[model samples]
Target: MSWGVRSILHGLDFVLQNIAWKPGIDSDLNVWSTRWVDGGMPEPVDFLLEEGFGFMKDFRIKDLCYNGGGRNEGMVRLIFKQESVDKILPTPLISTRSHDEVFWPFSDEVRYTVKSGYGVIFGEFFNNKGTLKDKERLNLKKKRFCKTTLWKLPGPQLWKILLWKIITGSLPIGSEFIKRNLGWDPFCTLCGKELKEVETLEHLFRDCDVSSRIWFGSVLGIRTDQNTFLELGEWIINWITYLKGQKENYYGLTHFLVTLNSIWTLRNNSIFRGESFVQKVFFKQLGSLVSLAIKNPVMKITNDGEGVFNSNDSEDLEDELNCLKDALLVLVID
Candidate 1:
């Protein structure tokens, strides 16, 4: 029995001691004459007295003992049996390797991601650390060209196009038939000048006295009446190259690109539309193109360095004013 129950029974026994409700040989003999240990108590697993030993609490009291008395003989026997079984069983051995090395589970995506991120781990194990660090480090300032929105293009591509345009201007010295075939001259329909080998692509676009006046007087607001052929072409290339460098200058870049596109469009219109390229009509169209370009994401120039732009703000007023003047003359009339 547990200690609690044993204590309660001991108290009951004390209360009933020496109480004679009837004669010793009368009803009391049948009631209290039979002792609890004689028949009512449970049998012990083993008795300390049978083993010829005195009760000693210190001698192999496995876990719990009931006051160093004979009451816990069964619990003591149980503890000794448990200790014997534990001694017969061997302890388990643990492996020295890490969990990943010894008990790794396979996962296709995890393995692929690791391999793709760092290449093969075997190479990393064998390669020099300094060499690996150098290969991975990025150096932005060493780049030859700034990134542009036009497919992340470099400045060299613009230089190539400008060079091609210059070469086309020198190709008219071949023959009279070649000059007429290449849209070089139509007898200057207005001035009736004898257009010959001197009338090249550059002459058509910039050198003609009529086109030169329109270009310098209105758009550039500078006198180009005495400007040389090389000077005008150089100016145009420099303007485009600078605009491309400042790609984030959306308000300015948009005006520049759209104006260039419109100028080419006007040239084509004069060649194929069968209409005289009047300066006033062309300027109005160029104005519309500039307005449309400002609203779109094309050169998204913002006042702040981050490139946030308002289509109608005085912040880019100077760029807009210059762009408007240049675009009107270059695209519409020049």
Candidate 2:
């Protein structure tokens, strides 16, 4: 064969070996030979094979399911051993009653793409035991989280992009500039000369005295310096995910994003305009920003005409307002 044709054949062989059949109504997957199970093994081991069922070796996956697309549990239990039956029983059948699809198992969407294919190739060639390394796995997780959760967050598009930059270390912070050898000083302008902390995303957003005060004084009352997370990106993901889970209406998340945006705005104002951090002014701006977010058309108001952003009870609203009042007391004390 020609070299180009040989290469194509080799690629085709690799694809065939890795692709799996998603069970559908018209599945043509062989009961014995197809790698449709989770462990990538073919169904029905040699020891599990009964002499009487030798004639059924050529049967398709559809033969084990009912016409209405439910599994034939009785027949499956009788024909296959418990191990094979265990694997087959949990395999989800497509609800659409369509033809079976061949899918790449590694991707989130289960469709073959050049990126996933390249990842598979890289894992096989460079990784130990054909698995992704820790860094690769983390990158994959971040990509998935961004696609499914971060990008879908309710806010202005610019806010989401800013968050993306922060998590990906793409924000033009001083530490990032130093890493790129851009001839910029890495010391935080926000923290001043005496502290001289490096201006990393984590330090600027979470560890700095200014930022920590804002977080502690906010309605969420988060103590930014107390977290155990080593990385800012992971910390943001974990906190945001927890915030999202706290309320279906996303009150905690909205407050978090608004507070974060306000902090960034304050940081910029300090750097560009030589503005000093004022607690009263910062708290006022934060309260207004959060209020605006609650009033935004995208935010769902409660049914009782209370104009509350989330589905939380009136008691929760009272508690939040009381927290805000307490936060304002910090301005007096400072």
Instruction: Please give, for residues 89-162, the per-residue lDDT of candidate 2 as tens digits.
Output: 65656656577767666565556777877877766422554433445544654665687677667655556888
User: How does candidate 1 score on lDDT?
Assistant: 0.36
Q: List model 1 lDDT by residue over 211-285, tens digit each.
A: 565455444333444334333334344444444434245355445445444444555555555446576766677
Which regions of candidate 1 are displaced past 4 Å?
Answer: 1-198, 217-219, 226-233, 241-253, 302-334
Task: Highest TM-score: give the candidate number.
Answer: 2
Determine the backbone clash count of candidate 1. Answer: 2
